[model samples]
Target: MDESNSRSHTEEIPEFVGPYKIEGPLGVGGMGRVYSARHKVLNIPVAIKVFFRDVNEKPASAKRFIQEARLAASIEHINLVRVMECGNDQDDHPYYVMEKMSSSILLEMKKNGNYSEREAIDIGESVARGMSVAHHHSIIHRDLKPDNIMVSVDGLYKVGDLGLAKLQDIENTSPGLTMTKTGLGTPHFMSPEQALDAAHADARADIFSLGASLYFMVTGKKPFEDEGVQAIINENYEKGGPDPGGLNSDLSAGFCQLVKKCMAYKPEERYQTMENVHQELIDLRHRFHDSVKPIHFDTCFDLAGTKKEEIERLMEQHAKAASDKPKKEPVNKLYIVIIVALLILLLFLLKYIAL
Candidate 1:
């Protein structure tokens, strides 16, 4: 069972978690509860992710939680949320501080339906760019989803929540938690390899996830969605991916093809590196440079009219002018030719008269 969602903040809300004071609850997940906090002296706002009591009760889970913090802290990328620090409270629960984002991409998605082609591609590009850095360091974000991606007020998209991330090197594994053949990660976005065996799941698994996430961004729907987690996992293992273009007809062939390549069932068939996905998105953006638009509208248009007659009169005049604008007289080539000929004859006559 996914404990992150089941478990609530068991411990009483403390005024402070380490040096940071808790402002409020951000959200709860399968692993732990996240809180909006601020540094005592610095007064800097940060997000503090703390493991639940049940997770902390187990040594393996505690170590894994801390490991997630360290792994995230190690990776430095603008597209990724920065881990500021990690610490333990008096209760022995593990928690880590991350740079707080103004809002999450998931929240934005809920507010606004599907993202535009350019917006979706841009978000995908940023995520792939961050994942490329993680892959370079042998880290794979097993649970890459819209909910895990954060968007800042300044329009910067970043990858966050590395609880399910796996480090490539086995020797660097956390003390208690061992990377077993057990499958881990969200069922809907999981790759075949990840579903079959998480231990062996590699960078390709993340590629599949990124593709799935991209599909969701453009279509406002999950590729493989079912009532049960097992059902979704089974579908991902047996069936082909849902056509992104089918849901969003505006999507181009290149966009659909890129998505299909990413969501390929076989890991070998999918993109081998995050860099490849990133490059493809870059090219896609270039292909539609002229049509690329701002991710969000900058200005709002007020439609209220102060004077009813003034508005109606102006609209009527505009419509009348627009209707008449294209009514052009057809030019007569014969008349033009005759006029030129007559002018030439008159010039000759004038010359004859002068002579």
Candidate 2:
């Protein structure tokens, strides 16, 4: 058995939850406990998230859990975790089954230390692709952290755990479902606007969280750190974190700029859509790893606060430098002919003298 899916001796493992047999507890979250389970009839491995009895007693929590299932199940993207089924258990608690993942990004990070710049870019791109689809459907993933990104056995990175997602078209029918309270999401990764009012968060909010998560992946440290939760939340709200490149000097300037743009203080300053974020990551990959050419002017221009005059000046200098570069002169045909003639004459002279 994989160490990640090891049975938890602390919690009692249920023999069955609906039609699935619980093999062991995968992990516990704020609203539910996930378990490694198998379908009773098909015998296929799956993950079942069963809500706590207290959560089921609360209408808001129950509604949110069901929404998570419905929203995730409706989307079909390779980069998003697939929801198999959702129903209630014998104990009257809500439960949802999803495809079992090999491990989460958080677990992988802990096991393999911090990811390199290239690895972080790959993970960020996959997440952006998945989130872009969700955004198109008018879903805002209010919570996006390494813990919510799962890695499959085949090494595909998938975005999971959408319990806190905000659907634009959906109404908050439950009395307490409105996220008017402050500090609604994970403090370290939440955007400033989201920390203030999660109900109004949009695609840009998810971009901010993705930037924070990428910062952690490269630097091995959370964007905001504090002794108290409220202090961290305050830091995220009042003051933005340091540049990711400053933490990890090995990261490329373009990548650092991309991350900084994503974590911009205001939503308007950040990338407007997940598709834009994905495209930036793609450009970063080419600029940092694949291409031997200089960074694109438009890429630098896209970064917030980058001056147009400076970019144009730099591009002009690059062009001038290329034009001024000295080229290798071709071998002189006359010189080669003279040398060959001299060699032939010397050979003839030596042969005649010997005779």
- Candidate 2: stretches off by over 4 Å: 1-11, 171-176, 227-230, 233-241, 291-355
- Per-residue lDDT of candidate 1, residues 11-52 (tens digit): 567788898899998988656889999999999999999888
Cα TM-score of candidate 2? 0.77
Clashes of 1: 4
Global lDDT for candidate 2? 0.84
Model 2 lDDT per residue over 1-355, tens place: 5322333334466899999988988887767788999989999999999886644678778888888898899899999999989888998888999999999889998999999999999999999999999999988888899999999979999999987886875555544565676556787888877777777777898999999999999998988777455676576557654588888888888888888888888888888999999999999888776543354565565657768777666666676777788999999999999999999999999999999
Clashing pairs in 2: none
Over 4 Å off, model 1? 1-6, 171-176, 227-230, 237-239, 290-355
How accurate locally is residue 37 in candidate 2, as Cα lDDT from 0 to 100? 94
lDDT of 2 at 238: 74
- The per-residue C-alpha lDDT of model 1 at residue 293 equals 32
lDDT of 1: 0.83
Error of 1 at 310 (Å): 24
